[model samples]
Target chain A: MMRAFFRVAWIVVKKDLTIEVRSLEILSTTIFFAVTVVLMFSFGLVVDGRPLNDVAAAILWVAIAFSGTLALGRTFERERHNDTLRALLLAPADRPALYVGKLAGILLLLALVELVLVPLVGLLFAAPIFVHGFHLVALLAGGTIGFTAVGTLFAAMLVRARSRDVLLPIMLYPMTVPVMIAGVRGTAALFQPTPDLAVAQFWIGLLGFFDVVFVTLALWTFDPVMTD
Target chain B: MHSDFETLAVIDVARHYGRRKALSHVNFTCAAGDIIGLLGPNGAGKSTLLNILATLLAASRGRVEYGGRTAEQAGADIRGRIGMLGHDLFLYPELTARENLVFFAQLYGLSGAHARVQAALDRAGLGDRADDFMSGFSRGMRQRVALERALLHAPRLLLLDEPFTGLDQASTKALVDRLRECQQAGCIVVLATHDLDIVDGVLSRAVFLQNGRQVGEPGPGTALRERYRQAMTT
Candidate 1:
């Protein structure tokens, strides 16, 4: 059973990657959107010679949140249009395995987007992102896992709903408040002058706790929510 | 362990959508090698029945059984032995035919996936076109690929909803021939289709449905189109 679960998760990730690599639909669009959001923020948030205090972290997290929402919706939208989710659901694999696999794929896609967006944010806002690099990475990982874990569940749940485009953010943003708050607060700590590593670590730890709880809830709920 | 089921039994199965009943008290039994045809009109619940059998949608009442065990009792692994091709073909358009089949084959954990995928590709009859993305294929070609995709796992119960839709004559003939091949392999093939004439000679048994209820007793014989016409009219 464990073998089947991992096998299914790995194959789903492979399938997602192959399709994404060929089309460049999700990765390219997501990165473009993230960068655009950051640029938009740079316009509003930057002052005489620098971004306002603590605004850099807020802008970065906001860009990640908004663009990550788009990425999650678009990812499942591909499956929805083709009704391929039905095929996946009809597979012999476990439902939670499918959820975990999709979450992994979305995380990878967002990680790539952030690779560009984070540096761009640092360059524009002068946020010193690489100063507390390892803590920042840990924080981002914890926050993203929490965010996409819930996002994956909701995106999949809404795949069959009419007006899913309208519903995704409405359903997503609320359920992911903990993720968003932790991500922003942790990154704020990291971005502050003379970074508060302890505070950032605390928020990162809180994000990790949320990740565990959110993933467990998602895996537990995925099978029933996906079923008609 | 999942493939050993010889019979798929629908026992008093019914599915409802709010107040609308899509299928009601439907019953049938299909043993391995039997080609069961579900013939019906536009709103007659043919797809609903097929979906129920595929276990994609649960019946609101009663149950579906593979061999002697119900779907819930048999567990999800029972789905490993069930394959379906429906109105939605479930193929990723960006992927090549080989890629799609290989994906499904690997998901099924089929040993020798390369050979299996090649065989499926040949069955799809794409030949030189197999390497191209399916987004470029015509509807008939896509249908063929989807059929092969569904069959790649060598499922014990092959459920098809409107399997003949959008096929040219040659492709339709090819599809019927493949159904025979599945029957020969001792697989239970259930077809829900409006092409009663096309499936007339191939069906091991025919069940006519109207407004979610069976109209007549199912039997295997000639002149199925005429029989279906009378069943629906009456």
Candidate 2:
């Protein structure tokens, strides 16, 4: 069963990746949106001449969170369109495998977007992002996993609803606030000259706990939702 | 085990949709090589019955036993032994024909996914199209791909809901031929189709359903048409 789960997970992830590669809509759109958010924030903050550290984390998290939500919504909407969601449901594999596969795919995309946005945000805001490279990267990794876990599950649910396109962001933003909060705070603390491992560890620990709880719940709920 | 080899026994299966009854006190049995055609006007619970057997939906009451094990006790294990083709094609249009089959074989935990995929395509008469992208294929080709997917795992039981839809004459002939191959392999094939073309040769027995009740198990000759006529009038 474990083997089947991972095998199915890999297949689903490949399918999603292939779709993105073919269309290029998700990759290009998310990058453009994230960059725009960064640029808009930079413009607003430039006139005041405030230090970059004050709002750098907030700008990064908000931009990444909304862009991530858009990408997640598109992933599921694509599945529901051709009844590929039903195809996955019909596969003779464990349901958690589906969840893990989708979660991994979303995280992969999120990681790619963040990879570019991180450096750009630093250059635009004149902040010391590279100085806290390892710690900040770890914080982003932890928060992205947690965010995608909930986002993928909710994306599956919203795809079947009547107002799926509109309802997704409204539903996603509230659930994602905690991860964003922990992520922004951790990143902000890491930018300090004396980086606080304690703050970073706290948020990472919280992110881990969130992953465990939601992943378990998502597994249990997926069977019922996928069937219907 | 051989004593119950050909039996699909159901013990008082019932289903409910909230406060409404979808299926009520249904009981039936089918033997190996028997292709029973389910018939009803609409909302006669045909889908509900097929859904339970396909393991896609659950019954609110009673149990289903196939080859002597309760379906609930052997859900995952039973799924391995059953092939299902529903209204959904369940294929990735972006992927090649071979890729889709390989993926499903992996899901079924088959180690030699490559050989199984080849065998399935060969049987479906799609070996030449194996490398072709699926999006360009016609509906008949898609249906054939779905049929091959159902048989890739070598399921002991095949459950098809409205399998005859969207097939041209040649493809339909190919489908009937493949179904015969399945029966020859000793797999119990259950077809939920409205097409009465197979009333004589394919199925040994047919169950006539009307308003969630089994009126009778008609024999191979002249029974399906007679039963369908009897069902509609009454």
Candidate 3:
């Protein structure tokens, strides 16, 4: 049973990746949005050609949150476009396994976006991202998991909804408040002059806890929410 | 992936959308090797009934059973035996015929997927077009491929909603032949369609539905389409 769950999850991941790699729709759009948001922030905040304190961290997390939302919506929209999700749900695969596969795909997509996003933030705001890169990765991984875990669930719940496009961000932003706060604080701590590792670690730990609780909740509820 | 299920029992199944009833106390049973037709008008809840049987939608009241087991009791395993070819066809336009079949085959964890997909492609007369993107395929071709995709697991219970919505004569004939093959294999086939003409030789018995309720079977010597029209009007 366990083996079947993992196998189904992996197959879904492969199918999603195959489609994404072919179209590059979500990847290109998400990257462009993130880059543009950071650039817009750079122009508005860096008024005197000197960066505002800790704004790079704030901007990076915001770009991720914003771009991540777009990616999630687009990913499920593709499923709804063809009603392939119905076929998938009709399959014998475990519901949580399907959720895991979708969550993984979104994570991989956002992670690619971040590869461009982090360096852009560092360059634009002179944040020391490279200096504490490892700790920063931990923070990003934790925060992203929390956000996408809840996101995959809600996006699925809304796949059949008439107003999914308008409702995604509205429903998502409020639920992800804790993730955003912890992510911003953790990365902001890393960009500081002394690099407060202890504080960053604490926030990362909190994000980790949030991921665990929400992932469990998402896995538990995905079947019920998706079954119409 | 031949299922051990011998019967699909739908008991007192009623479905409601808000205050409107889509199906009410609908009851039927299909045994293995039975090619049952669910005939009805546009608002007759044919598709709704098919969706419920496929486990894609829960009935507002009552339940569906596979081999005397409720879906809840059987869990996800019941789905393994249920194959559905819905209105959408469920084929990704971006993927090729081969890719689409292989993906679904893998999901079912079916071994020898390559051989099975090749056979399915050949069966659909799509062997040469296996690698070609489905975006370029015609509606008839896509329907054929989608039919094959749904049967990749050799599901014991096949629920098809308007499996012949749009098709050429050749495709329609091919689909009827395929349905017969499934019946020979002891697969319980339930189809909901408005193609009353094509179902002449295909349906062993048909259950007419109107306004979400099952109308009585045709009186002896009443033509199927005549019975269908009577069911719709009276």
Candidate 4:
């Protein structure tokens, strides 16, 4: 069962990567959007030391989360527009396995985008995020897993809706507040090099829990949503 | 693949979408190795009945049984043994034909998935195009790929909705030939199609569904078509 899960997961990731390589549109556009958001933040914040350090994690994650949602929303939108997702639904696999495959695809893309954005944002804001390095990456991954799981489920619904581009963030943001809060709070802890790992671990664990809960819910619900 | 599916039965199944009744008290049976053709006009619930049997949709009322096992109780087991091909080709446009098949093979949890996909490709006459990108393929070529994907898991029952849609005369002949091979291999094939020309000899039995009801007993030959024509005209 475990082998089956990862095999399906890997195939979905490969399919998304194949498309990304050919088009080169969604990836570049997402990165450009992220850079533009970073530049806007720089212009608005004025680069003062204390205020910059305090909210830097919040700005970084929020920007990544919203932009990542756009990329994911477009994932199924592209498939549905071309009627590709419908074909997939006809395949003789367990529906929940397909849900896992889709979640992995979106999560993989979000992770790849964030790897580039993290340091660029740190440089833009003159914050010390990269100082802790690996720990910060783990925190980012934890938050992203939860976000992508929920985001993919909602995106499948919005794919067929007329106002999907506008509806995705509106539907996803309110539900992901807990994830956003935990992401920022955990990242902030990692950056500061505090003696207490408890608080950071607590937030990261909360994000992890959210990941598990939403992933289960999404698997249970994705078939009905995808069919619609 | 089961050689004996005489026990597969659909009992008084009905389905509704909001206020509109799609399928009403549908009763049908397919004995082992039977190639059943479900024929009806648009909104006649041919697709709805097949979708319910494929376990993709639930019947509002009634039951389906395969080998005396209720589809509801045997949902997972039944799904594992069945393959479905709907209107959408469903291939990832960017992935090579090989990638697409392997992806579905993994989903079906097939052992030696790579080899099964290769065999399915050969069955669909797509072996030469295994590495080609599906996005650039012709409509007939894409449908072939979809057929290969559907056949990859060696399903005992095949549910194809309008499988002849984008095919040329030659391609359609090839598909019929492949259907014959599947029938010989003991796979129960069920399809819903508007193309009566192809159904004349291809179906073991053709069922006429008019306004969501099966008009009479389905049987072989021109009688099924006559009943279908009369029911639809009336």
For lDDT, the strongest prediction is 3
Clashes of each: 0, 0, 0, 2
TM-score of chain B of each: 0.95, 0.91, 0.96, 0.92
Candidate 3: tens digits of C-alpha lDDT, residues B1-234: 333579888999999999999999888888989999999879989989998888888989998988888888888878988899988989888889999999999887789999999999999999999999999999999999999999999999898988888898988999999999999999999999989899976888898899999888767466778878887777
Question: Interface-residue RMSD per candidate?
Answer: 1.0, 2.1, 0.9, 2.9
Q: Native-contact recovery for every candidate?
A: 0.81, 0.40, 0.79, 0.45
Considering the two chains of model 1, state its CAPRI-style docking category: medium
lDDT of 1 by residue, A1-228 (tens): 899898999999999999999889988888898899889889888988688888888888888888889999999988987789989988878989999889999999999998998999999999888788999899889988888999999999899889888998898889888888888888999898888888998998899899999999999999977777
User: Which candidate number would show the highest DockQ if scored against the true structure?
Assistant: 3
- Give the CA lDDT, 0 to 100, for residue B143 in model 4: 88
The estimated TM-scores of all candidates read: 0.96, 0.87, 0.97, 0.87
Candidate 2 Cα errors over 4 Å, as ranges: A1-5, A40-54, A157-159, A166-171, A191-197, A224-228, B1-6, B197-201, B208-223
Ranking by TM-score: 3, 1, 2, 4
Tell me the tens digit of each residue's lDDT in model 4 across B69-128: 776566455676777787877677878888888877876668898888888888777889
Ranking by lDDT: 3, 1, 2, 4
lDDT, candidate 2, at B31: 71
lDDT of 3 by residue, A1-228 (tens): 889888889999999999999999999999999999999999999977778888999999999999999999999998998789999998888988999999999999999999999999988898888898899999999999999999889899899899998999899999999999999999999999899999999999999999999999999888987878
Model 4 regions lying over 4 Å from their true place: A47-55, A81-94, A157-167, A188-202, A219-228, B1-6, B216-225
Error of 1 at B77 (Å): 2.1
Q: How accurate is candidate 2 locally (lDDT)?
A: 0.78
